[model samples]
Target: MSRPQGVGDGGQGHKAKHTVLALAVAALNFGIAQGFFAPLENHPSLLQARLGLEAAQAQLRATQSPVSLQAQGGVSFFEVTPPPGPPTCPNPLNPQCITLPSDGRQITLGLTFTPFPFGDVSDAVNQAAIGVEQAALGLRQARTQLEAQAVEAFLRVRLAERGLEVARLGVRLAQASLEAAKLRESRGAASPSEVRQAEASLRQAALQQADAERNLTLAKQGLADLVGPSSDPPPRLIVPSEGTPPQVRQAELQLANAQVAYDRAVRGVLPVVQGSYTRNTSDNDSLTLSLNSRTLQPSLSYTNQSQGRSAPQDRIVGTLQIGLSANIAFGVLDALEAAQKQVEAARQAVEAARRSSKQQEDLLRSALQTAEQGLANAQQARSDAERSLAEARERERLGLASPLATLQAELALAQAQLNLEQAELGRTQRILDLYRFYALPLSEVNR
Candidate 1:
């Protein structure tokens, strides 16, 4: 009779509406999940740490670069004229100063290079290498510190949220008590004072709720500042596994770097032997050789020279000669002594750092243990409070308890819940702190 038109249209509309609702619900759940599990990469502290690492890497590269080479070169031009009215030419074959050229010009080109020898370059290279290693350690420390900050902020936010929930629950219970008091007053079963007291409690509960909300906002802002801004909801806080603390690793790295620095300093005052060969070509050609002992302050040089211009009858000549020099500096002894003392100091520093790291680790372990015990006790208190609240509510419904008594029980339960949340948060934070000490990533908790 309906020609199936209404059945087809109506059925299609119902299916479409259901499909839209399902899609909306799925999207909401997905968004909640995403907010609850924000990745560490989004954290502002980690981003800053990454930037620091990049800077450190750049510094290391600069440090590792080769030293600048030392070089000098020049050209000189000059003219020679006969002195006074006399000719000083040795050749007598030509009279009237014909043997000497009236106008003569001379040009000279010279160059010198001081190569970077092994012994001479070792100190600088060693220092640069140590710098690179130190930079790497700095980057690691920054990352560890950033992760710890992010974890702490996340935990605070979770605590604030739970506190807000307890506050709201308290407000609800206070309102119920106020309504009961008013009814009892109307029946002359309770005095007007009870109603006034209930009203005051309600106001107090509202104030607490407002304070909790403000705390939650501040906590969320702190976390967002560290992780960067995000549209997604905040993730649940998870307790990271206990791992190697960053402080220990950082201390070890410092000790290693100090040792390297001390070794390099010692090498600075040590003996260095260097050799060089040089060649020069100008009006005359020459070869020069040199050796130096820096520790002894002794040096030797040899040179061979030949005249550039010559005639058959007047031949050019060649000559070779050797020279030596030496020096003594009292400052060298002082420098060497200072370096030795520095080495000793570095060794002591290493030992001190080791002891400090050990103590810190022990303290953190003890703290974590204490936090775990406290959390257990809070959980037990919370369970007891729940049972008490339930019994109070039952007695009130049975007319065996006053509305005020039931309200008091409810408040106690809320307080117990708040304490339990704090205990849980504290325990988790302590665990994360231990993990952070070991330089473990917060993301490891997900695993």
Candidate 2:
């Protein structure tokens, strides 16, 4: 006899539809994951870091072009009258001692500039460039930190999910034990106390399952918070690849930045030289040129003047002046000594940072090795527990062991599984932490 044609056709059709559905679901999931991680630069933390880098770059540019220019111009209306007493004029024929004109205007214009010199300005530019480098490093560090946090949160969710599964299994085992105990009591083979104990165990398991469910929900929410809102579920936890530690590099960067700061502080007390020019126009038009340094200043000025009571009687005079001056502030030597001390202090700090980084790297390496050993041990224990449980079940099937003994074996197996899962989670977490210390991107580390 052959199977009905309709029944065989229906089975094949159902399988084909199921396969198509699974493929569509898998494609959708792949697209979602690609979309989530594609725009890494646009992540909120990275965007903020990029802004900080841009600001530092702007400051560096400003320091590179440090020059000051100033211009002033104004118009003034003025009228002058002689005092009540006799006029005190240098020229007796000037205006014939008459009243001054009521309508007169004077225009004034001036321009001054100070160019950036080599001493302080150069130091500032160098410091700003260092700042830009620090900002870039800070951005990289922030990215590393954020990725580590995301992975940690994801792992926590995975751990919670595992815990919930174990809790559910525990409840099932407890209920089965309770049922077996009640059956034995009805058959007069088990005491009432045993039934009561079994009931208590089942209740405890139910409570544990509830707690596990609550924890799982909280974990899922935390994972959602880290990855932002999305319809897709959390991605599977991927173990990161081992890489070289970043502590040494981080220490080097700190030392370089400290050196830059120390150099800037030392330059702060050094001599400064500035060159300046000024042009002024008033009753007298003057042009001034000057060169100034820490100790000496030399200047020259040329002036052209026009003075009279009327336009035709105006007299024009031109004058030239030159001068030199010297200045010595005793405080600059004191400042130099203080800056030297600061440089020494910064040098010491660099050494301290280097030593600390070395210590941290060594400690993490040791911890990673320990965690791997622990995971291996847990896996072996789980294998033994599974084997024992299988033997206990076979013995019960042959009526050579009590139901309670088989249930105990199942409970042991469940505990072993839970321990193994926890050990695995711990190992994964430690590996990720090591990857983070190495400054490896979680996405690339997974690859």
Candidate 3:
């Protein structure tokens, strides 16, 4: 629903109202938006797709070398004539040898696109999903906190409003007392000392009224910050439903998400499947096939090399090769080790995050309990004050109590009523907190 036009700068004056519905809606919207943006930022497959072009810059160098094929045949029995090693032909697709095209040697095929493992991509997407989910939860929690704050602010404004009224009433009562004293003094029934006392009380009451007005002003401003300036009418504290709050059940979700992330990171050690084909001109042509099924690769290549660039005397040759290229030109072991360490570190971070979430739950629970107890105590005090006020009014009506006495009793009663109202508000806020921490439905609590 659209809100009424508010006061102040339309953009900068944005303020969320202190209402259960508003709070809940804000939280849900924030959560949904956060989740939607996850893939664009942190998802692995998404990131890989974005980074593909950058990696191409380096992969382009792969074409510079000619594909070489080496064939080794193991005979069950020693042969008088052993087949020569696979002729270094242009078989770039072959993982067995480094093809150097600049040496006017065999042309090797370009590196074939080996689709990244689904397992790893799935893990990344899952991790990102979890993070976005958690962020949304956090935003909801923040909204809840804001809701609680708005409720409290409203209560404060009410207290200040009532306080100001009481102060004004005190001033009036004091003036009445002074007038009575003056009348009695004129008839010689009241002494000068009594008149002085009445005058002092009036002055004191005026000061108190001023103080109360200032307090009220501050309270109104505080509420204004939350719900925007609703000069439409003063806001009131809503009686929130008596029940648990809505929260992200972070303690459990954290542990669950972390375990999943850790599992995914560990699973990344598996080699990705790879295959490629290449044909070159230095020799007639060559085709190499490679599959990354394990740490080591098992591959094959078929090549037909002419004596020169011509296809004349081009003999067909095929070689079966098993190549383990863990380390060759550059120290790729360091890179592999770094990747493994990165995965391991992520696993550790997940565990840490889970622990932190657990601690937060415990702390929030403690706060909720304490606030609830305080509210109960405040309510009891209010009931007693109300009874006292009733008795004082009855006595004043009967002329058994002085106006001063009755005025004091009324003042106390007003303060107590304000306190009770505040307590009720506080309890409602604490309940909202619980809902935020548990990720429970706001509807469940608000209803």
Candidate 4:
């Protein structure tokens, strides 16, 4: 009230605005979280992969169950006419001849189980089981890739924000420089050329601001495309100390599948054994057992039947049969050789994948070390800029330097700060690359 506090209200408002902006900037600098990728679960590609895995699992279950059941029902009608004279009345017959109409209905339900005593059934089941495992690994591979993409998108947004912050500071410094130059020109201390240079610098700063704004907008859009318009800051990504690369596991599964195939091919036309028990509504029950090879089959069956309800007499029958067969085809041998080759190829592929993975891990570690060095350089540059800015301000206060020089020093400090941020981003990116390469989960926030 002594000098009217309202006069300083504009300064207070500016301070408040700057404070809000600072907070906003701080909020933008958040780490990634496991929940950041929650929306990825519903992504179409991931959903499709999940469905594929489910289908593979269902196929496995079906292969494991060899039993089957069938139900059948039918109706039949018939009419019979007696011959006209009934064999010229050779036997005593009724004078009136009539047509007989008959209708029959039957319902049958049958249950059968066929078990392969040889390796055929086991081989098929194992193949199906392997398919399920492969599908599962495929899903994991897809998820890891998607998570890496999300991380990159998030980093892009953060980088854009940081760039924008630097651009804004640049604009402010340029504006201050332009004002100082105009004042000096009005006092005959600076020439018109200096004023024009200051104006050009301001325009350049404005251009940079525009570019940064555009970049930020694009980055935000890209991030929204993946996570669907997330306003909350992402949590920091935590790198795991150790983990297996997805490629290694995928290669291992492939090797397993190939080995199974090779084993089946090596079996080379084995014998088969089957047993079945079937019952139907026609009062018929049967058990059949068979053992067969490519060249011969021996079968035994037992049946119990009641022909009609009126008779109600049980009939029992047993039958044995032997069948001989021959196949001139020699494709089995060729298949065995091919399968052997495939097994060898898969083994080699596994080794190759492991080697490639190790190489990538080593490369990422080296890159991370390089990123650390870059960050250190940026920190040192920023320190030097800070000292220069302080000296410039002191000189300006002592009337030994122009205000524009002080502003230029401030701009340099801002640039150094931006470089430090970029270096940090680079380091984070290298770490993320390592994490993705290892297929490590990003949920470990403690680290």
Output the number of the TM-score-best candidate: 4
User: Any idea what lDDT model 1 has?
Assistant: 0.64
Residue by residue across 1-447, what tens digits does model 2's lDDT show?
765676887888988999999998777656654544444556788889989999999998876653434444444455665545455656656555555544433333333232543444555666677778778776777776766666566667767877887788788889888898999999999999999999999999999999999998997787666676543433444544444445555555555655555565555555565665655544456566666553233445544434323443224333333444434567866666666666677667767766776687677778878888999999999999999999999999999997778877877887887788788777767766665676766554332
Q: What local distance difference test score does each model get?
A: 0.64, 0.67, 0.58, 0.73
Measure candidate 3: CA RMSD: 15.5
Clashes of each: 10, 0, 24, 6
For all predictions, the C-alpha RMSD in Å is 12.0, 10.9, 15.5, 12.5
Model 4's alpha-carbon lDDT is 0.73
lDDT tens per residue, model 1, 13-131: 98899999999866666565444435555555556666766776675555444432223333444455554435575655545554344333333333322243233344444555555
Instruction: Look at candidate 1 and give me any clashing residue pairs.
Output: 36-235, 43-227, 44-226, 44-227, 244-438, 245-437, 245-438, 246-437, 246-438, 246-439
Q: Lowest summed lDDT over 10 consecutive residues: which window, candidate 2?
A: 105-114
Which regions of candidate 3 deviate over 4 angstroms?
1-119, 187-194, 229-273, 278-324, 327-406, 432-444
Cα lDDT for residue 112, candidate 2: 29
TM-score of model 2 relative to the true fold?
Answer: 0.68
- Of candidates 3 and 1, the better by TM-score: 1
> TM-scores, in order shown?
0.66, 0.68, 0.52, 0.73
Per-residue accuracy of model 3 over 1-447 as CA lDDT, tens digit each: 665575555533455333566788767655543332222234343345445534443343332222334553222322244324476746645545433332232333233332332444344445555554555555445444554555567668877887887788789788989998999999999999999999999999999999999999999888776655543322222323323222224444555565565555444444344544443423556667666543223344554432244334344344444443332335445555655666566566666665665677677667777877988898888888888888988998999997777777777877777777677666666665655555443322332
Model 4, which residues run further than 4 Å from truth?
1-32, 71-118, 273-316, 320-328, 394-402, 444-447
